[model samples]
Target: MGIITGVIGHWGWEVEDYLLDVWEAHRTPIILATSSILICVWLYLYFSEEREGLVALPRQYTVETKRTSPFQLSNPLPTTKPKVVGEKATTVGPKRIRGEIPRQTTQKESPKRDGLEIQVLVFYSSLTGKTEKAVKDLVEVSQEEINGAGTGTCRFPDAQILDLSEIDYDEYFINPPKREDGKAVDYFYLLLLPSYNIDTINDTFLEHLKETHNDFRIDSAPLSNLVGYSVFGFGDREGWPTEEDGYGFQAKEVDRWMAKLTGRKRAFPLGLGDLKMDGKARLLEWSSGLIDVLRMFAQTGVLGDGVRGSGDADESDGEYASDEEEDTETSIEGNEKPTKNKGSIDDVEDLGKMVAPSEKAPLAIDFTTYGKSKPVNIQTPQAKEMVPKTSPTYAALTKQGYSIIGSHSGVKICRWTKSALRGRGSCYKYSFYGINSHQCMESTPSLSCSNKCVFCWRHGTNPVGTIWRWQVDPPDLIFSGIKEAHYKKIKMMRGVPGVRAERFQEAMRIRHCALSLVGEPIFYPHINEFVGMLHAERISTFLVCNAQHPDQLAALKPITQLYVSIDAADKESLRRIDRPLHRDFWERFQRCLEILREKRFKQRTVFRLTLVKGFNIDEAVKGYADLVDKALPCFVEIKGVTYCGTSTSSSAGLTMANVPFYAEIQEFVEALNHELNSRGLEYGIAAEHAHSCCALLASARFKKNGKWHTRIDYDRFFDLWEERGPDGDWTPEDYMGEETPEWATWGNGGFDPRDTRVDRKGRKIEV
Candidate 1:
């Protein structure tokens, strides 16, 4: 054993020496390889484990579940056991795993698949209950019509009337409502809304519609599923005459919003009715039209070709096209044809033909040469009628309740006249100048004017010209025609509700003539002859003229009273307010004031100031005072501008905000009174008609013995005119009447005691 151990030990020592040499040579490479392998293993393990953790995290934290229904209650019953005092706690019912509560599935019945039935939902908002009643009537009529239609594949159920104030907007407006009975049905929405300046449910409903259309989280046209929609509005034309003036404003807003929500599915044009005038007739027409459309839809499942409801084309496109065609046709003379390009001599000749006169029409006469130049029979182009029967202006005027008499004259029953017939009230003239409103005739001899006032109630439809260039109608024909038309209008009012029997009879006899119905009355060349016709019939005339016509004002004969409208204080303001066509309008206005100053003693001259809040009310006191200083008139009638609610007024930037309130008018009158007094002008506040937002400032000449003598004795004035003729040497003082009534004085309300004050619904208002 010792020998074997010795041999092994010797071998081991030899092997160790060889191995040590080998380790020293390869130890560095082996260490580097081992370190690189450890790093690779660590990186693989770290990244793979992280990936595995991420993949497993959702499984641990979240449980797969169905989507919760929007109508489902979000709150679930508690599952945890409650500990009772002095009692052993036990697990309640079943313990729910956290984040593992099973979603209670609410299987809402899907909307019925059948599309053969139509469900019409009539919605309305009423302030004074008129619209509500109107809706009821409309629904009844619609149901009858639908019943009359024979049963077919597409049947109409009874229309449901829903008050907008009572219904949940989300149930219907957010999206078309599904029938609770799970019946497949299509919906047609109809809205009848009354407009009010005051806040009402219509405002809230309109706001919701607007917000729904603009919401980003929901579909913009969520209600596009609706079959169709229509809106009708009721308004008072006497107070709010046009849409631009806020007449049926809320209805317009609803129509606009519904058009957006329904993907431009306006089933009908927005229908508007004046509540006091044509509400029932207009509503019946709209309802009939809607019923016809509904029947058509049921039969064909389409709104029909070229129907407005089927698309979003502009309503005015056809009219605009027609106007363009007319313009093109009128530019070409006689039988001449228009060329696309004017490069040829033939085209040039065609253009020259445009200036030539037609042989068929009579040559225009030069009336200005009657006195100065010799009368020459020139071959000028024939003059067109001031307002032809077929013209759009004539149509527009007729629509606004005016009876166009002959070619140039128009007559209409003023609101004040209607009020007096109803025994509600009279005009400011009744309180200030002793004129009976019931016996007054408001007519205009000329339908053309020189200026386009922003507040013109004509809706900018009246013809405007720098000079008279149309066929002139004789004064007698105008006189007889206007009286006949005026009488006819008065006779129609006899059957109206609230028209007094005695007043109705009295209204037949025209006692006074107000020449300020519309347009510049003095624009008529035979204005003096017209005045003579009125005076001959013992009718007192009140002639109102725009200050643009100085020459006409100078030539005007004596009348009961002369009024010159002073709309603005200076040239720039005048341009903005009057929008006169004549470049020398300011010069003409100044000259008219000079002429008025001369006629102050001979006639009862006055300055009428219509104060538009934003345009002419502020810082214009001194300017108006300067005008008063220039005119030196007998009276200064100040009134707030009446908003005419038209697109033209809106385009001119005039809004309801531009109309001054009665308080503002009062403040303006006070300021003017102070300014006039400061200028040594003996003018005092003579009267006020608060209902009309008008105040009168008169010269001291009209005040006698501590009372105002502003009222004119009409009989005495007529007698004086007949005795001394139009150029009589009599002064205004000779015809001044008794003292002004106490109720019409500066502080009094100016409402006649005999007439009962009434609200819009004709209910008596307690004093």
Candidate 2:
């Protein structure tokens, strides 16, 4: 250490002494220099970064001119503007202007909206093109109206249509994208989302919006800078069940979700376009209403309902919008049942408000409204081939011509219903079970059956499934829709000659509901609840099962009557007769029979044998008796299969020869009775309906002291059900033993050929 100090002293001549002397001599100058540098740095930071919230950088900028790519081109710089002495030259690239503010940095100052160039965003999802076309029609009609009116203030009408399927669900769910300019672009919005089937929202494109909104769910305040939106549903009311929310369920759900997300008021009421009716007219009407609403919003800076504040946040300057919306239900038959004293469709056009009190009744729909005379093009996809009841094509038909009761149930005017309406003849059911043919609402709770019967008249166009593939509609809506559709058919028959108004009115009351429509009725998840609903209305429910869903049958509530379709007596015949989906269909069939036997004492059980002569008639007496013993139903309806004009199903190959004659059906019934009697089971032929080629075999138990009690006393059964309620354990004995009405018994009232009817030889008048 001494040697190093000596070497330093030799070079600097006492360095420690020199440093001490210098500090004492220039201490003030050194301290002033340090203070000046610190002051200069603070001034630079305060001037550059203090005012705006944007990021700031130092005044001296670094420029990198090197290029990494070999293909980089070298270009001469453009001639620069002459600069005055001491003027700063601007460095251009992606840098922001120093002190300039953009015109659209906030919601209140959007230049596009202020310039009267209003645009709406329309998003839709549709398996069929009906919903998409409905949206387009609205936009097109709105544009034409805007141009025609020439209201310069709200002049330009531009709607940005987008498919929900095209959106990035994951990206939007994490963080909704915003405009690059940091402005809240104000615009009106519409959604035309249809439910995939009766009970689900799978196919609707708005599902992404739902997912994104749910991810960032907020309860305290509305979404930042969101605007009001309107909802439109495109669906067939008949396609959905009343017990379910029907076709409008999906649209309602979307509207509710959006309302919660934005905390914004609805621009207009929910615009519903029926899939089966005149959607173009409905779309046009909705668009016209929307224009009025938009005009009101533009002129007064408020909606007819209420006003929203101009600020970006949710807090409003005026009162929060009133929920004065009316509750209305639209059925397939253009039936609108208003649950409240609210405005009609015409009221909106006059008052420029969606909500108002009115006493106008629902107008009768003109068939001409569905004519091709209207220039408006409502695009519906035409199937290249015949559609099954389960196919999207058949589903689309509900939106076209077929009367859908609810999401799953459908009501079509049957051949028998038509015959009865024309005063020709009633259905075999009427003769067999006392069902009023004209007053019967023929529908199934489910369109998708588990078994695709070879003799199915639907041609397998409807959906089929081992389990329920659709959602269950609400019971209330299904009941209402069913009655509406049934009555609509009766109303159409009002113009026909010989149709009694009293009978038509009684038909409107809907005394009987036949769940024997094309599909399997038991597949509906809420079958029991639906039965209760029918009973509540004093309507008789005769639910027919395909004997595939034993569990569903077992859990079923007692209705007015229950019919199990015994298509075949043996397993092989069963497979050939009813193309079942289940591998263990035989076991399932046996189980269903066991359930029927168990439920026989609680409900009127009938084994419906559809006698296809050439198929299962060979050695079928003993086989049928065994099945009868297993079920032990109160009655058996042995009916000959009527040949409806055939198509794509196996039954299509059948000719008139396939349809057994009335005598053949009677022979089968007698043989079945003999087989049952031989086994000490008292089964005897009770009555016959010759016109329908059907016969009823009643249990000897139903005949007390030679008085027959085969027919159901529906009112008494309803009373018993009501007294017992859903959880009751009452038996059939509680309400049974009533003598069959003479008029309802098969032989007492048969189809009279004397009435003028449309037959193979055109109109025939019988004397």
Candidate 3:
């Protein structure tokens, strides 16, 4: 027990001695408290300094201990690098933090490096000029920030601004320049994109970016070859906070895309300005912040300082605030005035004057109330009359081998007409009319026709119109003009061996006028008068109408023959074949036939069916017979297509397939004959012109005692026509029965199609 006590006392003495030694130290509490306070102060200062320079880097990476490459960070000073015209700029050699001072290099400065300044390029796309104005303001403000002596070592002394829409993509991006050291240097890009529809990316800028970068990924990517760029968008706030509704989404979208493409080191935070508010002020604010970013990049070569906080000065335009106040005051005044007007006695007195006025013009009268036609409004005449040019029409006609006559008429020497001139033969019309083809003057009063027939022999170059708005030539002038033009054409054939001088002289007499030249001859408003003039000159007239203008046809005066061109048998076929300008063309065609039916007995009414092969030929025999029964005309002419080459007017791309062979035409004609016979129409093939690929169908009415009286007695017709004058009465039966002379009959009359090697007179040339 004594020994334990002695040990315990010894431990206690050692503890007391240690406590006495601690207490003997001088100012121990004061020293400890001072040290603690100093440490806390140092920590606060260090952390606060760190926060000022902290940057929000991309989420993909964090800062590490390793040094950064030169391209990633700039040192305190860099020897100015010269720009070689065609060389590339050098990239970073090592990756390091901006705080890490790089080893300085000593080298002789190249002459090209002298006066070289860092460049900033601004591209903007704007529709309402707001963004454009903002861009101008930015340039004006940034000039001071990036340039001047106060910019220190980070100043960009030069900048170029361009409309994003106008830049050449290749010269800027594809062919980027290089420094003399064979390294590619990148310039900073400031893009101000104005969204077209609030949320939609600016198409002009997007397209420009797409065209410049072939493989720039907007969504996901391994970002390589990053080019430092910043973007902002100008938009309006119409809808917000919905899945597809927002303002400045385009700005966010572009910012995201740039990050994915070039990484956050090269992309800056999106800047947005609402165009609906103080857009100019917001834009200036964004620019001011962006300038700091540019300075950081120029000085440190790293994106260090984060997005600028709103502590910066408000550069908002004071004029805008004043304007808003004025607008508010104006609105209040406008409201107060309306309220006063409602209560004022003076306003009530003028209530009648405030009532809306009637729409009727002063002194207006309605003539229609008295059952009179509405008076035509006489507008002031045009300063210059529109004298329609016949030249372009004439040129197109001539290019397709037509001869022009007078201003509106045209003449073409048909092969048959030429054949007859050389004594070879005449056209089938000659056989049907007892007229000489060579003496038949083919002319028209109007060259424009509205119908675009698929098998048109004129190759569809004939100009078309609904009305006669053209300068007209008097019938006398046309008669004389046609004679002169025909003779001139005949004179050109003088040296040709087969052209008979006697036949040519006879051709000049002009005994017959076929107004079937290349147009709807009946479209001429003066057609009836023209017919009277033709009969006056003792010229037998054969006028061909497209059957489109019925009123014109119904008003026609009697001629030796009045023919309607039938291109298709049914309504569908008619639409497909004729391509008529009138939408109600089928109805118009029916009305035309009704007119023809009424006039069938007045004139030698004929239906000239221009049969196209593989088109209106199959099963069309029935359709043709139905039409034949409708009008019960004196004759029906079926002619095979002579395939004219590609027509200026759509021809359904007619080829040889559209053209029927001679045998096919004969088969179709025979089928048509059987159909007509079965219908008890008593129509029979009168004759067929083999060389012409045409057949004639004569109605039983024209068969006098089983003999066809198809030929017109030209002299008797002229006598009747002249005797009756323009207002005279006449019928086809008046001159229907002159025996068709053998030479003017179909089989023996015109030139043969099989004998195409005929001379100019249509006589088969013996080899």
lDDT of 2 by residue, 101-218 (tens): 1111012222233434345678787767777787777677677654443244444356678777776644332223454786434445677787655333343434654654555333
Residue-by-residue lDDT tens digits, candidate 1, 286-348: 776667667766655544322222322212211112222110111111122222222211210
Best by TM-score: 1
Tens digits of per-residue lDDT, candidate 3, 1-767, equal 99999999999999998888877875689689899999999999977875564443334322222221223322222232222222333222343222221222111111222233455778777777777887887788678776752234334646788886677654554433344785434456677876666433265455544443344332122222233567766767655422125565565555544433332323343555666775676666556555655665455443331111101111111211222211010101011211112221120011122223462113222212212223232233421111133334443344333456666677755556666654555677756555677777777777777776766654434456554545556677766676776655543333232343345456657788888876777876567777777777788888888887777777787788888988888989888888777666777788888888888777788999987866788879888888888988888888887764443323366676778887887788888889888878788877666667787888777777667778877788888766776456877777876755554354453443322344322244542
Winner on lDDT (1 vs 3): 1
Candidate 2: RMSD to truth: 26.3
> Which residues of candidate 1, in runs, are more than 4 Å off?
1-381
Local distance difference test scores for all models: 0.73, 0.59, 0.58
Candidate 2: where are CA atoms >4 Å away?
1-392, 395-401, 650-653, 737-749, 752-767
Error of 2 at 551 (Å): 0.9
TM-score of candidate 2 to 2 decimals = 0.48
If scored against the real structure, what TM-score would every candidate get? 0.53, 0.48, 0.48
